[model samples]
Target chain A: MRATYMFGAGDVRVIDVPDPVIERPTDAIVRIVRACVCGSDLHPYHGLPATAEGIPMGHEFVGVVEETGRDVATLKKGDLVIAPFAWSDGTCDFCREGLHTSCRHGGFWGRNGIGGGQAEAVRVPLADGTLVKVPVGEDSALLASLLTLSDVYGTGYHAAVKAGVNERTTVTVIGDGAVGLMAVLSAKQLGAERIILMGRHQARTDLGREFGATDVVAERGEAGIAAVRELTGGDGTHTVLEAVGHMPAYRQAIGVVRPGGVISRVGVPQYEEAPIGFGSLFGPNVTLTGGPAPVRAYIEPLLPRVLDGSVNPGRVFDREVGLEQTPEAYKAMDAREALKVLVRP
Target chain B: MRATYMFGAGDVRVIDVPDPVIERPTDAIVRIVRACVCGSDLHPYHGLPATAEGIPMGHEFVGVVEETGRDVATLKKGDLVIAPFAWSDGTCDFCREGLHTSCRHGGFWGRNGIGGGQAEAVRVPLADGTLVKVPVGEDSALLASLLTLSDVYGTGYHAAVKAGVNERTTVTVIGDGAVGLMAVLSAKQLGAERIILMGRHQARTDLGREFGATDVVAERGEAGIAAVRELTGGDGTHTVLEAVGHMPAYRQAIGVVRPGGVISRVGVPQYEEAPIGFGSLFGPNVTLTGGPAPVRAYIEPLLPRVLDGSVNPGRVFDREVGLEQTPEAYKAMDAREALKVLVRP
Candidate 1:
């Protein structure tokens, strides 16, 4: 089997590797059918001193059960499934509360002896608790959309839900990447009346409009806030979806959320500390929420929409690559040459 | 007119001051009938170099309107009323959303050229919006409870409501001061099934139990968190009411809130920044909300409870003083000799 390994900053290679096999009674070996390079993956690829050594790389994948351990009962050989960005033992208190990212017995792939999903074959632990089976023989576009359910799309849904998006909500989705675009779609699905997409990219903004953005603010910083204020009648938005983790993104969310409104931040925060004193939140009474999404919990609810062909989030994949081209996929995304890349194993 | 002034840290003095008079078309002059030394008032009494010059002090008071400007239609001479911690125009977008603290034309007492409430007379701007009229005749106890509506009790109610407390919720209220005890009462009124009061003072905790605290954790720091976890079967409480602005109180609230739970902080925030990174809130999906209570907004809803004898938040006051002894009231509260003190002007 061929597997993608990131050795260091700006380094990615697809090399022939031993096939994955079940190592525990609750494990299963999955043959990867579809995978993708996530925006967060760029963090390590661009350079992470803590991750100096080469390691197995992906967390999002759609696959088929090649084999299951003796204890696996819910799934069988040849079953199609999708794994969330992180695996969780679904029976824990956190998982029961729909917070799988905080599961007691599960952690992220690419580390902690767990196998990455960006390979021809990989081992999945806690098989019954982690994997969600999908319908067999889906079209390529639908497959790409289903692949997003593993992480990005579900994450956007989580942000919109946390921000309290609904028919009466007027929202502003920060950022214009794949996740941000998906947030506009999710907010629309949740019945938001107006969605302001704050992005500088013309192509992405056009796509955002297609995804249900009622307005677009291309300015950055205070000017961006002024633009949103102009759109919201100078009162600010009812919900601010913070899909970018940068300080400026958060600043925009805080600035534009109306008094008593909310800011749901879901971009894997980059700042270690944030000012949440009287001036930032208290005076206006803003609710701040969001984190790594419980993709496992969202997958079931969003599957019906993807199946019905009502939402085509896969339109975000502007480029596609084979397993051998994984390294170049990273470069294309890093250089902003591709919106997002769909990879085939 | 007599007014209480804080000359410096631990220095409170009562002195003669000119009586307040209406100066604006929307202004009304009110004679103080009742005022209290709030827990937060101690912030300035115990040293606010910024407030170094002795100024009339007090932001919590119930009064009788003695005079009204030509434009003041809602309030008139000899009307009984209560003022929130801050005054707003009541017509701003923020005021319309029940976030009066952020009102564009409003500001807190004793700052921004506004007159403080703890004096023989007070000049209230935006009288129609700032004052909530009370029934002509009520017992001192009811009046005291209504006084709490101006700040303390309303603040606790804000904390509980923002934390989303309800019949199905379990709550943990940090601090055992007047506000914390009131939070216990507010949570009970909100139908919280279980409420934990965290405080080291047995007397305060005893009052908390009377106010509806189902459990009490006398620990602090990590041990406090462990105790709460143990109480909730190692899962933590569903809602945390942060009524104390101290670092440890905020930390305990953040540490004990269950995944997908909320931390509503109504304490006058003392910290400028908080860590909301991956390790703090991003992974578990916690929501944070709350600030200065929109006391004016809550007054109408909570007044009926006080009127029908369903709640007696005035029990938080353990001492009584006259205008001449207002300085002693501050000393008593600051020394912890009294939980709270009420002053009659």
Candidate 2:
């Protein structure tokens, strides 16, 4: 089986690897139907050092179950399904609390000897808890949108939900990436009155507008904060959905969040320390929230919207590639030529 | 008139000061009937450098409206009122949103030439907004609890409310100070099923238990975290109400919070930076929130409970001192000899 691996910074390749097989009674073998490059994957693509064995990649995927262990109860071979970024045992306390990302028995894909999703086939642990069955057929056009439920869309939804966005809220999203656009869509779906998208790219911001951003700010840093505040009547937005996890983005979140509002960061943070004392979050009563999205908990509610054509999150996939072209998929996304690159294995 | 002043670290004195007069149409002069030493007051007492012009002390007070400016509508002369620590004009976006602490026309009690609550009379700006009318008389037995509604009780309740405490939540309060005891009482009032009070003082913890702490963890650092984990089946509590502003209390909040839980810090943070990256909050989905309590917003709802005898937040005050003995009041609280000091002018 061919799988994606990063040989070093800016180096990605599809190489032959041993096929995955169900190794535990709770595991299942999934033949990947679709997968994609993520913005988070760029973190390693930019700084990961070369290794002898290389590192497996990809954490989001939709697949058809090829084989299942005897203990798997709710799923069977040939079921079309989506896998959240992390696998969890549904019965764990954290999982029961709808925080599957922190499940005690769960671990992220592509770690701890697990096969990456950007492969022809992968072993999924805790299959019953990790995979949400999709009623659509493998050939359904809704597959692309349904695939987003596994991570991006659900992540954006989580940011909005955690931030308490509602019809009375004015939101500012500080990224033009697929996740940020999904956040705009989610805020709109949740009934946010206004959304401001801060991005330099015209094409992406245009898509953001289509997704319900009522305003756009092309500036960065202090000027960007001024623009957002101006758009929000000098008070900034009620919620700042921060989908860019860099220090500057975090600073802008602090700058443009209204007093008593929330800053929800969906992007994987690139830095650790940030100001949260009286000078920032504490003085204004700003809430700092957001984390690895527990997409497993969100899939059930968001799936119906995708199936009903009320939302079109698949528009984020501006490019697609075949299994052998996975390397180009990474390059295209890294070069900003593609918002998100879909992969067919 | 006499007012409390902090001339330097470890120094508090009552000194003659000019009587306050209304400087704005919205202002009213409050004759101090009751004032108290706060944990936060100790911050300046412990570290404030010596100065020619000493900082005025105290922010919590229940008083009589001695005089009101022509524009003061809701309050009149001789009315009994509880003033929140901060003053604000009631008609601002932040105030309208129930975030009076962030009111556009608001300021703290002791700053900007305003008289502190410990003075013989305080000229309260935005009288209609900052003071809540208390139905009880100055001689009522509930005066102590009503005084708490000005700061301590309201601040603790803010922590619980911001953390979203409810019947299903297990709460851990990280302080035994007056505010911490108030937090235990607030959590119980909010219906938290399990309340863990983390403090070492026997008398304080005993009062905390009476206030509804189901368990007491007297250990600090790792031992404290372990004790809390053991109490919650190794998952920690669903909500951590942090009433201590120091870094250690913040660290303990991180150590014992369950995944996807909330940390509500009501205490004024003494530090500016803390970890919030993958190694801490982000990975576990912990939401960091809470700030200075908008006591003005909380006073109305909590007043009924205080009046009805269902809650006794006033029990936190263990000692009393006259205005002339304000120096000793600070000493007793600083030495932990008194849970909180009630001041009579």
Candidate 3:
């Protein structure tokens, strides 16, 4: 089978690899239908400590169950499904508390030892808990939505919810990536009265506006915060969704949120130590929440909305290609030429 | 009137000063009954930025209203009361959101233009919103509780509540100061099943145990995190209250909390920047909430408990002195000679 492997930073390639068979009683094998380049994947591409040689690439995917282990339940061969980036045992205390991303036995799909989704076929362990089955015969356009539910959509929704987005909230979404766009959608769905998307790209900014972004700020750094404050009647937004995981972006998100408001960050921190202003956090009474997304917990609540066409997150997939072209797709994504590039096996 | 002032780091003196009079329509003058040294007060004592002035000292005090301005309606002359550290209008959006500590027009006492409580008489602005009236003719012993209600007790309660303490929660409280000790009591009152007080003094630890602390860990750093984990069946506590405002204490609190659990920080951050691991924060799905002690909001709910004998946090006060000894009290608190020192003016 052909799979994507990273030899070094910016060295992702599609290569022939041995097929995966059930290595654990809970493992299941799936033939991927659609997958995409994720914002988190860019971290390793840009050279973080988590990136390594011979590492499998990609964590978001929608696929069909090709085989299942004897112990797996609630899923069968040929079921169309979406799997979250992190695989959990489903019974750990954190998982039981609906925080699967922090499950005691959970692990990321691509970073450490697991094979990822930017490939033709992949082995998924703990399939019954990690994969959500989509209703059969859904349109292919739903593939984009399913792919998003795997990570970006669930993550963006988690960010919005953590930021306490409600009918009275005025939100500032600090990114133009797929997750940020989806956060704008999530904010709108969560009944935020207004959403300001801070981004610099025309294409992604337009996508953000279409996804319920009521305002846009193309500036960065202090200027970005100034723009948000200017739009929020000079009090700052009531909620800020931080989707870019970097020091500057984090600072911007924290800066533009109103006193007693929140900064919900879904950005995968690219560095081990992100500098935070404790005085600002405590003095302003800000609430900070985010971590690996509890995607498993959000899928059930979000599936009906996605299936019923209440959200059109598929618009984020500006480009689509076959699995064989994933290397070029990675390049395009790295260059910021594509909002999100979908690949089908 | 005489008030305690800081001339420099470690330099405090009881000096004769002009008596305060009503300066605003919402102001009220109070004859301070009891004032106590706070951990935050030591921040300026240890010489941080803005620490080089003859600033009046003290914010936590229980007092009798000596006079009221024309617009002061909720409080009256001769009424006993506990004033929140932060003054708010009580009608702003932040106050209505139960975040009076972060009210738009909020101002702190005992810093800059605000007068301190360690004096014969002090002026309180936003008197109607910031001062909670205690029952008239309350005994002097109630002064201990009333004094605590002004800051430490309320701050501890704020930390516990923000940490989401409840019957099912296993709480770990960092710091053994008056606020941390009160947090042990607060967690117990909130029905926490297991309470661990991290402290070094056997006397204070005994008091904490009496206040419902099921365990005590004198060790700091990794050892402390290990002790908490061992107590929680290797899962760590569900709620952690951080009362010590320092880098090590903050890190320790974060290290010991369980995934999906809450860390409520009442420790005022003295540093402009705090180092946090964003990867670990988001990956573990932890929730952080904190800020200044919202004493005004909690006074109503907790006062009844204090008055009815359902809760008594006054046991934390280990020493009492006349206002003339305010300088010695600060020195004793600085040297950890007293768990908490209550001053009678």
Candidate 4:
């Protein structure tokens, strides 16, 4: 089986690896049908420190159950399914509370000797709890949108949900990336009346507008804040969706969030320290929330919307490539040539 | 009129000042009946630079309305009222949303030439919005508890409410100060099943236990975290009310919070930066929230409880001082000789 690996910075390759097999009673063997490179994957790609043993790449995927251990009662061979970025036992306390990302028995894919999703076949632990069955056939066009249930779409939705976006809310999304666009869509789905997309890229911002952004601010930093404030009648928005995790993005989030509003950060933060004292969040009563999305909890609820043609989150993937072109997929996404690259295994 | 002023670190004085009079159409002059030295006052008492023009001190107070300007329609002369630490025009968007602390036209009591509460009389701006009239007399025994609605009690309740405390939640309050004890009472009022109070002072912890702390962990740092974790089945509490402003308290909040839990901080954060990255908040899906309590929004709801003697938040006040003893009051609180000091002007 061929899988994706990054040996060093900016270096990605598709190499032959041993095929995955069900090794535990709760495990299942999945033949990857679709997977993708995540924005988070770029973090390690930019500075992972050169290693002789390269790490397996990718955590999102939609696959078919090729084999299942005896204990896997909910799934059978040939079932189509989506896997969240992390695997969790559904019965754990956190999982029962709909916070599957915090499940005690859960772990991320491509870690702890687990096979990455960007492979021909991968072993899925806690299969009954981790995989959500998709009723559509393998050749269905909805597969692209359904695959997003694995991570990005759910992540964007989580930001909006955490920030308490509703029909009465005015929101500002501070990015034009895949997740940011999804946040726009999610906010719209949740009935936010106004959404401002802060991004300089014309193409991406255009897509953002189509997804539900009522206004666009093609500025950054202080100027960006000014533009958002101007759009929001000088009070800023009720919610600022921080889709870019850099310090400046965080700063902008603070700058443009209205007093008593919320800043929901979905981006994996790049730095360890940031201002949250009287000078920022505390003084204005701004709430700082958002983290790894419990995509497993969101997948089922969002699936019906995709099936009903009410949303097309799959539009985030502007390009697609086969297993051998996985390296090009990384290059294109890294260079901003592709918003997100779908990988066909 | 006499008012308390801080000339420098450890230097407090009560000096004669001009009597307050209605200055704006929305203003009202209130004769102080009860005012208190807050934990926050110790901040300036410890490090404020010496100056020829001393800064006025104190914000929380219950007073009798002496005079009202033409626009002050709600407050009448002789009405006893509670003034939140900040004065807001209740008509603002933030105030209408029940976040009066962020009211656009609001300002703290002791800044920008406003008279501090620790004075014989105060000219309160936006009188109709800032003052919540109490149906009690000046000498009512409930005066102490009603005074708490101005700041401390409301601030503590704000932490509990922001953390989403409910019957299902297990709460950990990280300070034994007045606000921390009030948080225990508020958590109990909100029906939190398990309440853990973490503080080293037996006297304060005893008070905290009386306020509804089901368990007390009198340890610090790693031991404190271990003790809290042990109390909550090793998963930590669902909500951590951080009533201490220092970084260590914030660290403890991060350490003992369950995955998907909330850390609601009410303390005026002393530092400008802290960790909220993958190693702390992001990986675990922790929500860091809280800021100044919009006491104006909470006063009415909590007033009924205090009036009925269902809760006694005023027990946090351990001492009393007259106007001439203001200097000593600051000294006693700064030396940890008093939990809180009630001042009679």
Candidate 5:
């Protein structure tokens, strides 16, 4: 089977890889129908160092179940399924509470020993717990939306929900990436009265406005905070969705949120050490919550919305490519030429 | 009038000071009935650079209203009251949401130009908003309990509540100081099924057990994490209450918390930065929420419990001293000779 691999920094290639087979009693074999180049995937594509000689490279995919292990009770062969970013044993305490990222037996795809999801076929461990059956038929137009459930959209939704964004809330989304754009949509869907999208790119900000951003702040850092404050009449917004994991983005989120408001962060936090001291954040008593999205937990509830087409998060995908074009897709996204790139197997 | 003053690090003395009078239309002169040294007070007592030639100290006090400005509509000249650790205008949006600590016009005691609560007499700004009327007449046995409302108990309760401690939760209280001990009591009051207190001191741990800590981990750092994990069947607690603001304490709070769980921190955070990258905490998706307690917001709801004697959080007080002996009381607490010191003015 052919799979995408990052040989080194700025080096991505589609290479032939051995087929994945069920290695555990709880495993299932999935034939990938659609996959995408995730923002996180850019980590290695930038300079995280090659984790493996020929690492399989993706964690988000919608596929058909080709086979299931004997212990897989809830799923069967031929089922259309969406795999969350990580695989978890359904019964762990954290997983039970919808926090699958911390599952005791859970692990990430394309990392450690697991095969990546961006392939012709992949083996999914803890299959019953990680795979969500998409009841609808294989509708290609809906593939982008379904694939987002595996990570980005679910993550953005988690950010909005965790921040307690509601009909009365005014939210500021920091970062204009697909996840940030999606967060604007989620905040709107969650009934935020006003959404502020902070980004430098007019094209992205335009899409963000379409996604429900009432205003756009094109500045970064201190300037970004001033912009948000000005937009909010100097009181700042009630909620901040941090979809950019850099230090400046985090600081801006903290700076622009109103007193007692929350900063829900879902950006793949790229920075180390967040200074939360008495002078900066504790005095005003801000609530900080958000880690990885519990995609498995959000899928069922968000599925109906995706199916009904009330939210077509697929709009974030500006470019599409075939399996053979995966390497070029990575470059296009890395160069900021594509909002998000979807790939067909 | 006499008030406690911090002349330098490790120096606390009761010094003669001019008597306070109503300074604002919303001000009320409070003749302090009781005051106490808070754990945070020890911060300055230890090494926080002294502020002035005569800096007034303390932020936890219960007092009788000596006089009220005409604009102080809610407080009377003779009403007994407990002033929250901070003062705020009741009309601010943050104050209305019960986040008085973040009120636009709010300010903490003993800082800026405002007088500290731990004084013979204090001119409480925004008296109507900061002072919670304790309807009943003075009861000596309840003095300690009422004093706790000014800061310690309220802060502890805030920790438990922020962490979502409830009947179904298993909580771990880090730091067995007055606030941490109070958190144990608060967790019990909030209905946590199993409460774990992490402290190395047997004397403090004994008090913690008395305050409803079901288990005590006499370890620090990794050993502490292991102890908590072992106690919770290797899964860790669902709610971790962090009452110690030091770095190790913060790390332990993050380490022992269950995935998807919350770390409610009310300790005066002293650290400069917290590493929250995908490697450390983001992947596990822990929720960090807490700060200085919004004591004003909690006082009204917690007052009845203190009055009815259903909860006696005041047991955290272990020594009593006169206002003139405030310096000795500070040393006693700093030397770990007292859990808390109640001062009679």
Candidate 6:
């Protein structure tokens, strides 16, 4: 089987590797139909501690079950499914509360735990809880959208929801990447009246507008906040999604929200200690919430939308490559040549 | 009229000042029966920014309405009232949404707009929305407890409520000041089973126990968290009320809450920036909320309890002094000789 591995910073490769087999009773072996690189993957590719050592490179995927272990009850061979980024037991107190990411036995599919999806086949732990049936006989185009359900789309939605995006909200998303673009779609779906996309590139900015961004600000820092304020009648956006996890972006998200507004930060903060201005937050009374995407809770509802064609989040896939081209796909994504790179395994 | 003013750092003087008159059409002039020095006063006493100049001090008070402006409809002369630290018009969208502190026309009483409450007479702007009638004829002792309802007591309740304290919760309060001590009482009222008070002084800790702290932790940093963890069977507290706004206290509050727990921070953050580990918050799913106490909302319910002896938050005041002795009161509070200083003007 061909699989992707992070050799080091800026060193992603696709090479011949052994196929994953069921090592645990609750595991399932799935032949991945589609998968993609996540924004989080860049953390390791850029060489963060967790990804310093070469590790499996992908988590989001839709696939057909090739085999299942004895304890796997609901999943069987040839079942089409969407596996969330996190694998859980599905019955823990945390999982029951729909916080599967915090499940007691939960593990991220790729970097830290077992096999990931950017391969021909991979081992999935807690099959019953981790994999959701994608309704048999879904189209290949639908597969890409369902593939997104495995991570970014769900994460974007989670960020928006945490920030309390509603019909009356004016939201400014602080990134024009795939997740940020997906956030625009989610905010629109959730009835955000105005959506602002912050990005540097013209192409991605236009794509954001197409996906529901009511405006775009090419500037960064104080200038960006001024632009956002101008768009929001100088009161700032009611909700701002911080999808780019860095100091400047985080500050922008906090700065561009009105008094008593919320900043839903979905960008995985790479820094161990980000300086937060307590005075600003306390004075303006802003609410900050966001983490990893709770994909399991979202996959079910989102699947129906994808099946019915109400949402077209798959349009984010600007580049499609074969599994053998996984290394090139990572490069393209890293160099910002592609909004999203989908791989056919 | 007599008033307390901070001529500069370490200089508090009780001086003869002109009596406050109804300056605004919506204003009311009140004879302050009782007023107290607040933790925020220390910010100016220590000479921070705009407050470095000589300024009237105090934001918490219980008083009798001596006069009302032509536009005041809520109260007449001789009515006892609890005045919130913030004055709002209550006509703005922020006020309608119950965020009176963030009202467009809202202003802080002592430091910004209105004169300080630690004076014989206070000119309360937007009196109709700022002052709550103290159940007509409440006793002076009850009024003292009600006086705290103007600030710390209500702030503590706000912290507990924002932290989501309820019947089954185990709560940790991170400051032993008046507000922190009141938080212990508030937690009990909210039905929290195990209230842990974090303080260093024996007397304050003893007072905390009396105010419903089930346990006390005198340790400061990691040791404090370890003690709290041991108390909760290694899960940490369900809710953490950060009544001290300093960085260490803020970190302690964040460190001691369990996964999915809430941290309600109400203490005025004197510093501009503090380190925020987004990864820590995101991985654990902690909810952080708080700011200025929504005194208006809680004052109504709390007024009855204080009057009827159902609550005795006034016990947090360890010393009573005349307005002329407020400088010594500030020194005592700063030196930890007093938990709270009640001043009679």
- Which DockQ values do the candidates obtain, in the order shown? 0.77, 0.85, 0.68, 0.88, 0.72, 0.55
Please, what are the lDDT tens digits per residue for candidate 4 over residues B64-119?
99999998888899999999999999997889999998888999987898989999
lDDT of 2 at B255: 92
Candidate 3, residues A196-223, lDDT tens digits: the string is 9999998999989888998999999999
Candidate 5 docking category? medium
In candidate 6, list every pair of residues with a backbone clash.
none
Candidate 4 docking classification: high
Per-residue C-alpha lDDT of model 5 across residues B238-330, encoded as one tens digit per residue: 899999888899899878988777888899987768867775567677778888898888888888889889988888888999988989998
Which residue runs of candidate 1 sit more than 4 Å off their true CA positions? A50-53, A138-140, B50-53, B136-139
lDDT of 4 by residue, A246-324 (tens): 8999999999999888999999999999999999999888899999999999999999999998899999999999988
What is the lDDT of every predicted structure here?
Answer: 0.89, 0.92, 0.85, 0.92, 0.87, 0.84
Runs of candidate 3 with Cα error greater than 4 angstroms are: A48-53, A111-113, B48-53
Q: How well is each residue in A158-215 modelled by candidate 6, as lDDT tens digits?
A: 8888888999888999998888988998999899979999998888889889889999
Better of 2 and 6 by DockQ: 2
In order, the TM-score of chain B in each prediction is 0.97, 0.99, 0.95, 0.99, 0.97, 0.95
Q: Every prediction's TM-score for the first chain?
A: 0.97, 0.99, 0.96, 0.99, 0.96, 0.95
**lDDT of each residue in A161-234, candidate 5, tens digit only:** 99999999999999999999989999999999799999998999999999899999998888889988998889
- Greater DockQ among 1 and 5 belongs to 1
lDDT of 1 by residue, B111-130 (tens): 76666777888899899999
Please write out the lDDT profile of model 2 over residues A1-345, one tens digit for every residue. Answer: 999988889888899899898799999999999999899999999999987788888899999999999899999989999999889999988899899999989999888989888889899999999999988889999988988887899999999999999999999999999999999999999999799999998999999999999999999999999998888778898899999889999999999999999999999999887899999999999999999999999999999989999899999999999988988998898889999999999
- Pairwise lDDT winner, candidates 2 and 6: 2
Candidate 4 chain B, poorest ten consecutive residues by summed lDDT = B329-338
CA shift at A141, candidate 1, in angstroms?
Answer: 3.5
Error of 5 at B8 (Å): 1.5
